[model samples]
Target: MKKSLVYLAVGMLIFTICLGSSLITNQAKAAEEYKISVVLKALNSDYWKSVKAGAEAAAEKYGVNLSVIGPNNETQVIQQINLLEDQLVKGVQGLVVAPLRPQAAKTVLEKAVSRDIAVITIDTDADFEGKTSFAGTGNFQAAEKAGKYFADILAGQGKVAIIRGAAGDYIHDQRVDGFMQGIEGTAVEVVSVQPADSSRGKAVNVMQNIIQSYPDVNAVYATNDEMALGAERALKSANQAGVKVMGFDGSPDALKSIRNGELTATVKQDSYGIGYTGVELMVKHLAGETVASEVPVPTFIIDQNNVDASIRDLTKAFSRDRLEVLFGEDVIAEVFAE
Candidate 1:
């Protein structure tokens, strides 16, 4: 009986030690800060850089470790996938991505989900099965607004050309579809549709070619502000009569262009809001809170009527005073000028 009691006591002590050690290990894991990653389409534009700033701001606010990376340009599908896979291998607790191409990254995102890593999409939505949520603009509605405004300005009777972004991009397709829907049953005839792949130089070349073929083109609607600005430059060079230029993304350059009467109008998506909300939602999700599956930021048209207010808002969002110091006033003016 004494021997039996000794054995029982020894086993109980060992079991207590093991339980204590397990508890300690679990507590350490619970205390460890979550590492989150934000993978964007690319960091090539002011818009994306602003998104990075917003995400970083949120990470700081919520006490999470955050990493942001992207390809050199939007066309780097393979590069983007490789970067995402690298983040997965690093064991990020959560992920936010703006996929260059949806299907290309779907498999990798699914793998991440399988590993129980939370995935959120920003700026662009992915059709992945296990995506936690999407934080982006309603590109279709915004494009529709621009199209209807353009049609009204043209009095529903004019020749227009469209400069498109990357082919097969879901956002771009929706924008095109929305524009078509907005202009349906109107006399505004869409004369030319060309793919610039969202490159400013390519847009310039394409716009120049369109002018050569359709000299009477009354307006040009570009899927993005960069292309719109490039088209404007091409029009100016050819001395084409002020063909109304409409663009998307209320980029700083675009706002400045509106101020200088270079660009007729542009639809401004809430880029900062999208980035901040994406990280905020990820943090909430990591904390075991329920979050909406779709978060759509608002967008509006910025034209001469409200361009000044838009500039003020952007200055606040992007820290314009600092940007001016980094990139001189002349550079700012030139980039946004007519």
Candidate 2:
């Protein structure tokens, strides 16, 4: 009888240990599947869409739930703030944001920090003190490269017109400042500087006015690829010849233009790196790992000399496998069918 009682007690102890271990394993698995959110400036551009694709790829690789949202245009300050509030109220564990304005979203981001949510900034930094870290390219440095190349091509003497993005945007301001610094010692006089609100149509109109006002303008510099392309259209329509055009962002359209001799040159930012690193850094922070406060992806100049190599780099950086998942295989086929 004593032996039988001892055997029964041992069996009960073993069953309890097994049950406790199972519970612990299940709890750990649940904790590992954290929910993260990504807020972009706008989804209207190919650049932001590519960023979304990279973020989705990272979420799939890391087994995290991700929600990406953006306003129709970067100027929609109220709509962006509302979206941030919605995410915060939904109790997201982590957030990655690209602020449209320098100081516009600081208050709302601080509210997220107050609620103990981890915040990461990408593409553009918020002026908020609450952000955990930032992952993006050095816009100022990239613009400086474009400016120096532009100045060198003109032999450092010409009248140049400037078309910039929306006012008060930190990234746009940095690009303008960097370009000014790059051409400081050169004689490339900037005859006019106008804001196009980052719109292709607006840029075209602005370019038209600039050409009329400064008929002797020998070159043009646009802060982004879209504006640059727009300026290209305006120059073509006006039948203006021999005026060099330099742009920022090595977008697909810009690359094709360079190949066809429509655009002079552009600076390429690592869009994929920004998105991929944003998610990776946020995950690391959640896992209690130390991460840098600001992670910068490098940039480079792409001109006729290195356009082919730049194309290869851009194709590899924008993953076809991951993009096929976000966009259907048919869409990818149509886009790259050439």
Model 1, residue 257: what's the lDDT?
Answer: 78
What global local distance difference test value does model 1 have?
0.87
Over the stretch 1-338, how does candidate 2's per-residue lDDT look in tens digits? 99999999999999999999999887556546778999998888877877887788787777778899999987787888888889998879999999887487888889899999999999998767777899997888888887888889999989999899998778999899888888889998999989998888999999999989999998999999889989999999999988888888777678767867988988888777788889989888887889999999888888888776665555544667755554456745655654
Q: What lDDT would each prediction earn against the true structure? A: 0.87, 0.84
How many clashes in each candidate? Answer: 0, 0
Q: Write the per-residue lDDT of candidate 1 for residues 216-243, one digit (tens) a residue.
A: 9999999998899999999999999779
Model 1 residue 187 lDDT score: 95
- Give candidate 2's error at residue 192 in angstroms: 0.7
Candidate 1: lDDT of 264? 98
Reference-based lDDT, residue 163, model 1: 96
Best by lDDT: 1
